[model samples]
Target: MSLKSIFAIPFAKLATKKVYKWANKPFQTQEKVFQKLIADAKQTAFGKDHDFENIKTYEDFKKRVKVSDYEGLKPYVDRIVLGEQDVLWPGKPLYFAKTSGTTSGAKYIPITKESMPTHIKAARNALLFYILEKKDASFVDGKMIFLQGNPVLEDKNGIQLGRLSGIVAHFVPNYLLKNRLPSWETNCIEDWDTKVNAIVDETIDENMTVISGIPSWVQMYFEKLIAKTGKPIAEIFPNFNFFVYGGVNFEPYKNKFESLIGKKIDYVELYPASEGFIAYQDSQTAPGMLLQLNSGIFYEFIPATEFYDENPTRISIKEVRLGVNYVIILNTNAGLWGYNIGDTVEFTSLQPYRIKVTGRIKHFISAFGEHVIGKEVEKALKDSIKDTAINISEFTVAPQVNPESGLPYHEWFIEFENEPENLDDFTQKVDDSMQAQNIYYQDLIAGKVLRTLVIRKVKKGGFHEYMKSIGKFGGQNKIPQLSDNRKIADVLQNFLIE
Candidate 1:
């Protein structure tokens, strides 16, 4: 082993021990973080506006500070953008992690100096935990590539602004600089297709061991590597063994990734966002990611069922239960207060506060009151193809409210790597699985209010084409798993199989 890998062994153990201290005392750790956030920000504009000085308990916090989305907090963020100090947090944010927003154009999320290290630390701890569990730090000696946005930043009101991944890119430790791939010039290329091509050229013959990125984008890179080398990724980079990914569910893409790699390798799932590094998979055998209880953020959860209620029930980590679907809320050192990041999660383990991202709060198909979620649909499809040779590249679901034919039904647009022999049988299997999981969907079908769902085959590379058409072909962009309307389905019609 190289000196780096040899040194990583003891460091991994030390880091993981610190993680367990907080993980074992989750409630206490979170309460401490809660107290600190309120105490530190009491003099800031948001803190004062929300009556933080008198907020001594979680009850006081809920009553004084209301749950808010980006729009509700944008007023304070607007002032901060003009270089106002102590508007949200104290002083000014070190940077603004810019991300695409649906209705608000680009969103500028603040990253304070106090909160910045949490991002870096959590990412490092994720790998360190893996090394501790698997007893393997050999990958550290080999080249590592994280397919991320360009590290270039633009100045906005004296604060640097860039994509969250790009901002994080700037903070990569000096020790790993030589091991990271796709040199600076290639990363700065504006177009994704050209960038991927450049990445392929740069790393084609390198001793790459770890490849990380969003799954769909990584698949593109894998395809290019296979095409150019006439070999699976395993053969192209014989040392390649670790895959790191975030942003979306990996179950649907697992089979495709295995096929591309031509072998099963270790995988790590992360739950990082612009707001904070929330969680990461600590063990390969664990059901979900270990929540960062001692991170510079305090957490709250509102039941998904009651999220739309005027007075939704919000609770702290002390009251959360396993298997309940909740919309996660955040109050952080970055100055966000009761902020809804739109993600829905379910607790898999309460002892250490482990959670799995189920879906987005707004990304669901409830047109017929079935309230079908991203997790449900992904599970349904997974169940249908289990123990089979079938492979799916990508998919999305939408309600077909007004069909030309008989009754309205859910439409699943799937891009397949390996199609089932009997399309009708496969469709029926998926429909049956959906019915088994959701009572409302089953009732609708039995009541004759809606017919069984239909699957529309998307042409090869169709999703890629659609993404390119919308100018979001790559770099941290993801297709919503389900939509209430046909906005995506309408555009997908052009790519459907004849």
Candidate 2:
């Protein structure tokens, strides 16, 4: 198909009626989820909305319910599991997606049957769109390689709670679920040391097509895949069509993956959270596809620009303006209602409500008043080694004040396969990128006061193995991009420096 016909979009025109329906209907569904939360939140959340003294109507619920993070909602989740209809998604506990949250501590996120339909609808819509864009939906539908965490949800005790992704994995259409592809659990979960060894045996036989997962684990597997196959990745899986990833950005991973595969793996953005599977990339560059099931969420926005301290300028879904950087706030079924998802995003365009996820609200290095966001850190890393062919699999940034120097500088611990040429020069270039973006760091870099950032290289699968050791596998939670305090920082510090 020609670019004119294929890329043609009068999206506003195409989404005319549909767009109106989406904006308006979602608010109503949000209202239903809020009813239970509004009553339950009365005791715990203090103020349910951001600033409202008391929650009354749907609007009041939006006003009174403070935009909350995962930590804030734990009490309500406890109330919910005890048989309170705290948030009104459909069905029983079925199971909680076993997720070790960033701040909520180790916990189970409820996934209800009532709201699960939206997850299926949203995931399907994302897939349907990729097919429709190509005009041939079934062209590459032979086998799907889901690089997912197959963690069994365990209760407080050590027994296997059940596989989290297996909930949707088993529910997948039978015929399409092929025997050739490896089941996510077949030595996949980062469990015993034997699991990784088992994965090598099970996955080596089949040629894969589409691959999906977070970038950190995917790169880990690729290293193993390369070592096992001995041949280039393309030769191992010539049928590969796309690399669909959620939880972290894919811009940097593109070149390395393409180089490995000997072809460009089409990149697809996925927004899967412990709360629920949210948005996805409609086309590679269509700003991200909104989940078709927002009808079940009462969505709100908190401007990241306004997140000076903990307080943020909150706006309701209908009240949201375009081209604004805001943290995602949701009132969803299955317990969490009127909650701040702790993610930041901006609307690229409207009609279909297209948005760009800027970064997570809390996942930035703002400790030193520089206000460095995840997006900025990504840019800095990309520019640092512009000439070299090194791609970062996973990285975390922390604003550390050297006890002797007394100057706060950002410490970036990046995971790469091997060190690129001119490591010192590469670090300098990254400093240049940082100075250009963050003022405080810029001053330090220009004055030569910067503590000369440290870059440590780890063994190939170290990060992957680390995550598994903690019970955070492929299917569990978002990669820890930017941690808040020293608790996680200490854990990361032991492995980072020489």
Candidate 3:
């Protein structure tokens, strides 16, 4: 065994123990921990302004601090962006992670010193848990090639701003630094296509064992690697055994990614965002990611259906039930109190606190009261094309309300890496799978309230072209799987060849 592998074993064991303690804490002292978090921040300007001094209990904290989206909290955030201290959290943020907005310009999220460890430490524990579970440190013994955004941060006023991956890239440890592929200089390239080519050239001969990125961008990297080497990924990186991915569900791209790699490798799903590192898949045997309860962030769940309610019921960890779709509400150490991050999740397990990311709150098609989310669309597409030779590169679903003719329908725009032999049959299977999964959709069809889903097989690179047109071509910008309205659909039509 390598010297690195020997050290990794002991460290992995310690991380596992720490993660287990944190994962189980919510079952016992979640309320007390939450109260303490609120109490700790009570001296801040926001806490004072919101009357956090009176919040002695969890309910008081909830009642006092109104749940806010980015727009609602923008005024206070503006103060921080302009270099104000003690405005929201206890102190000024270390940096701001800028996330692309759906309808607006850009969202500047804070990454404070207090909250950085919550992200960085959880990321460390995730890998450690993976190492522990695999019973092998060779994965760590080799290099990792992460397809990330520019690590070179931009100065917005006096505060630093960049993509979350870029921010994290700046902090990759010294030991891993030797094993990490594609130097920071290469990662600093803003253009994804240009950066990916540079990454491929740099890491083509490296002893890579791990790959991490948003699935689509990683897929692009893999494709470029294969094109360059004229060999499957396994031939290039024999030690490559593990994959870590997040930002979007990997189910739709699984077959295509596996096909490119030419081997079945273990993968762990992460729930990291500009907001925080929420969770990670801890066990190879388990399906869902274990929610990090002891992370400096406190979490609450409101049922997705009642999310827009004037006083929606917010459930604590102990109060959350299995199988219910809940929109997440976070009260973090970073000063985001009762903030809605706009993602939805469903609990798969309560014992160790595991969850499956259902979808985004905004990225869903509910134009016809059939609230079909990204998760559903992805699952439906997977089921639809499972038996076929179809290899989907990317896809998105949008409602066709007030169509030129006939009943309104869901329109699927797909970019296939490998096209199905029978397109009609493939679309039929998709419609069948969606009907089976979503009752409202099934009912709408049965009642003739909507026509069958329309399938538009776009030319290869259609999704990419559309993203580029919208100035969202690179760096963790994924095609929305489902849009509530026809905004994306109408725009996408301009990119379609047929």
Candidate 4:
């Protein structure tokens, strides 16, 4: 082992121990964070407007601040964009993470000096936790590549503005500088395809070990590597035994990824966002990511089923229950208060508060009063393909409310890397799994209100084409697992294999 790996092992142990200190007392850590956020921001514009000084409890906070989305917070953000100080946080934000918005064209999420370190530390600690648990730190000696957005930044009123991943690129620890792959010039290449090709050229001969990124985009990179060398990734980089991914669930891509890499490798899931780094997979044996209660953010939970209801019940982390889907809200040091980031999660373990991302608040199929979420569809597909040679490249589901024949149904658009031998049997297996998991869906199917889901074979590269057409082809963008409306389904029709 190299000198770096030798040092990393001990450091990983120390860091992980530090994490356990707070992880062991999740509620207390979160309470401290909550109090600090409220106290520190009380003099800021948002705090004053929300009567933060009078807020002494979670109930007081709920009464003072209304849960808000980006549109609701835009007025304050607009002031900050115009070079105003103390509009949201004290002074001005250190950076603005520019992200694609649903209704708003582009969203600029503030990253304050106080809140920025938590993002970097959380990512680092995730790997350290893995090393500590596995007693392996040798990957630290090999070249590590994180496939991400262009690191190029544009100045916005003296605060740098760029994609969250790009902003993160600037803060890679000095110790890892020698081991990090893809030169800065290559990372700055604006076109993703060109950049990925350049990355392949640069790392083809390196002793690469750790690879990290969204699974879908990494699959694209893996495909490019295989195409260029006529070898699976494992053959190309024998030391590549660790994968770190976030942004989307990895189950649907697992079989395809194994085929690409030619073996199963250790994987770590993260819950990082433009707003904050919320959680990370702390143990290989654990079911969910350990929520970052000690991070510079306070958490709130609103049950997903009641999210759209008027006067929805909002509670603190202490009140959250396992297995219940809740829309996560944030109150951060970066000056976001009662902010809804659109993600819904379920606590998988409550002892130390571990959560699994269930779905997005807006990404669900409820066209027929049956709220089928991303987790259900993903689980159903995952279960159906078990003990088979089937490999799925990508998939998405949408309601087919006005079908030409019989009853309405859910339409699943799937791109297969390896097609099942019997398509009809496979479809039945998936439908059966879906019905078993969701009582409402089963009820609708039993009542003959909806037929079994129809699977539309999408031509290879169809999802890629759809994303490209929509100007979100790569770098943190992903196809939603399910949608209530026909927006995505209507566009997908053009790519269906007839």
Candidate 5:
């Protein structure tokens, strides 16, 4: 065995044991963690303002701190960007993670020194779990190429501002550093096209075993690599075995990835957002990602249907029931208390707290009371096309509340690499599939409250063009699959060819 292989096996085994210990502790010591986190922040400006000292129990903490969104904490976050200390966290933020905003402009999320390890540790444990599950360390000896954002951070006000992936790249463990691909200089290039080309050149002939990135962007890189080398990815990197993906559902792109790589490889999915590393797929045999309970973040779940209610029920990890969609609220070491990160998830398992990301809080279609989620829409589309030859590139769904002439219906704009011969038949299949999965949708249809779904084929490259027009074409940018209204749909109309 190679020296690197020998070194990685023992390290992987040790990390697996440590992660298991830490993960299980939250179940038994959740209240202790709640007390400790509050106690640690009691002296901070936010803590003092919120009367944190008197809080003693989980109930007290919930009563004192209101569930909040970005707008609720904008003032504190704005002050931190100006290099203010102790406004939120104990000290000035080490950096800021810029993310897509909702009603407001770009959101600048603070990342503190104390909370940085939470992101790092969860990521490390995810890989370690994969290692333990496979009982293989040979891949660790080979290089891992993570498609990350530009490491060249921009100064905003006084704090450093950059993508979360870029910030995470800066803290990859020392031992793994030796096996990481793509030179640091290349990683700093802001232009994604140029950076990806540089990565292809640097790692094309290297002993690469693992590749990690958002699925779409990684697919773009794979296409470029194949174009440049004139060989399948399997031939270019024979050791490449693990495909680490997050940010979007991998099902839509799974077949394409396998076709490019020339084989089906072990896959790991991560449930990481700019807010925190929330969960990871721990077992190859299991279906859902195990929620990270002890990773410096306290989580609460409110049923998605009741999210906008004045006093929605907040569920603890132990209280979560399987098959219910919940909007996650986080209290993180980064000093975000009761913050709603806007993503929605459904618990798949209660024993180990496993979950599947269902949709974003804002990305749901409820016109005519159908209440279709992004997960449902995406799944329906995938299911409808499974037996057909259609290959989808990207898609979005919007509610057509007031059509020029017909009953209100769901409108889909899809960009296809290969389309079904009969568009009406394709739309029928998708509509039938959606009805099968969502009872509300089926009821609405049967009651004559809604008509069949409408399909509009977007021009080739329309989705990417729209993303570029908004200056967010690459690196963690994904089109919202479902919207409550036609705001995104209206914008997408500009990109659709007649």
Candidate 6:
């Protein structure tokens, strides 16, 4: 490791001490953690009943409040974004973290003032972990490149300044401001097309020590780095010490990245969203660094199986189960109440709420960790697909294990507007994409988990028809890009090769 990585480790160790202590010792109950907000929400804010009517026990809060997505909290978010009274979190929110989700589309989530401490804690968690792992906090203390999203300038209302990533950046202490990659303003852009290319050009020769972003965006940057420089990525940013990515799963793309960079730089996976920084990469081998819930947010877990039920069970930090997958629902100090953030998690252990992200409950496959879930497969395909005409409009995956072979096979059905004339080559590319991206799938293919491989090309408009049939075209619910089985998968299954 370099000087920065080694020098900054003690600080990282101190960070571990703080965050681990915080995680291992979360509150006894949700109410105790969120008493202030529950008290505040009782007052009608913007003429809405957002407060706990009589929520006392953790059970009472779980029963009184249902898990919410963006739609469920639209009323609260709409009000808070308009700068109304504090509805969800206490005190005035500094800014909205305008982030994009596959389900909600684009949401400007409010980051309340009280929640700033939580964000700071999570940031410290990531920084601390990087330092501890590298044995060098000064490296991170030096310049770091957070290849993040910029705010959207919306004229819908007069002077609506929206930056999903910027809101988080807005909270960075002035002392750490200079440490940010691409001097806040210098790196941001109105046109993503030009902005991304420029990001590649500027850092091609920089002494970049740390690089962080969502995995999809980061992998794309890697591809761009390779295409433009025509040199291996290590040559592009030789001084780069670590890759810290969050907001999306990186496991599926691990192989592709390893293939590109030649050797693995230290990698950190963070779990931050519009709401707040959820988890960080402290132990390189652990599932995930359990978030410091003292971020002033109340975290609730709904068993993955219970996610869609009228009223499935909800468990608080006090009652979380280890080894079981759960849908993470958050009641952030950021004006979100009983929000189901749509992430599935498994506890590394229950003692301190250490968790590993299993998969989105809505998207995980139980049969074989095929986990062909939406996010995993999406990341896998996004990292794999190098063709433009074959850009997936919609797709879903199902494991059709051959009974005779006693092995599962990944059968994918995809909708594409542009069909390559050489269908065989196109299909091979998809298979290659999967093999190169998912080590498990690659191993399965080598083994029998995939006794065979198949890719089915569905009719151009068929997937849309299936989505329409399900009354889901766009918005909070679109056809999941990957799944165990659905109309899209069934329809496209016939196209797979035996």
* Model 1 clash number: 0
Question: In model 3, what is the error at residue 144, expressed in angstroms?
Answer: 0.9
lDDT of 2: 0.61
For model 3 the local lDDT of residue 134 reads 76
Give candidate 6's whole-model lDDT.
Answer: 0.63
lDDT of 6 by residue, 1-498 (tens): 445446456656776787666565677444556786576666546214533667666666665677778888787767666666555555456666555555667776776567767766677667676656655554644566676556334532322446556546666666566666665454567454456677777776666767777654565577678988787777776767678776545554555566677677778777767676777666766666665566767888877766778878777777776767778888766667778777787778555666666556656543565444454566555645553434444556776644445556676676554555776666666677666755766777776556545567777556546655554432113344455555456654444333
User: lDDT of each model, Cα atoms only?
Assistant: 0.93, 0.61, 0.85, 0.93, 0.85, 0.63
Query: Which stretches in model 6 have alpha-carbon errors above 4 Å?
Result: 1-10, 27-31, 44-53, 90-92, 100-105, 151-161, 183-186, 364-410, 413-453, 456-498
Q: What is the lDDT of residue 373 in candidate 6?
A: 48
The digit string of per-residue lDDT tens for model 1 on 1-498 reads 989899898999899998898889888898899999999999999998889999999999999999998899999999999989999899999999998887898999999999999999999999999888878899988888989998999999899999999999899899999999889899899899999999999999899988999999999999999999899999998888889999999998899899999998999999999999999999899899999988899999999999999898899999999989999999998999999999999999987889999999999998989999989999998988888888999999999999998999999999999999999999999999999999999999999989999999999999999999888988689999899999999999999989
The residue-by-residue lDDT of candidate 4 on 371-401, one tens digit each, is 9999999999899888788999999999999
- Candidate 1, residue 15: the lDDT equals 92
Candidate 5, RMSD to the unseen true structure: 1.9
- State which candidate, 2 or 5, has the greater lDDT: 5
Better of 2 and 5 by TM-score: 5
Between the candidate structures 4 and 5, which one is better when assessed by TM-score?
A: 4
Instruction: Give the TM-score of each candidate.
Output: 0.99, 0.80, 0.97, 0.99, 0.95, 0.72
Please state the error at residue 229 of candidate 1 in Å: 1.0
> For this target, which candidate reaches the highest lDDT against the unseen true structure?
1
Candidate 4 — which residues are off by over 4 angstroms? none
Q: Once model 1 is optimally superposed onto the true structure by TM-score, how far is the C-alpha of residue 447 displaced, in angstroms? A: 0.8
lDDT of 5 by residue, 387-423 (tens): 5657777888999988899688999999876778998
Output candidate 4 Cα RMSD: 0.9
Instruction: Report the C-alpha lDDT of model 2 over 1-498, residue by residue, as the tens digit.
Output: 333224323332353345346545655645565555555445433332243236667656644555556677777566555655433333345567665555556566777665556666566556655655665533244456665555344453222244456556655655455633555567345653355456556666665666776665566566677878787677777777777777776665665676667766677777866576667777665666564335356567777877665666666655677867788877665556666767888776555566667787767765555677777777778776456678666667666665445545566667774467787877777777777877876666567565655555544555655666566655445455665455445566556536
Candidate 5 residue runs with Cα over 4 Å from true position: 156-158, 387-389
Total backbone collisions, model 3 = 0
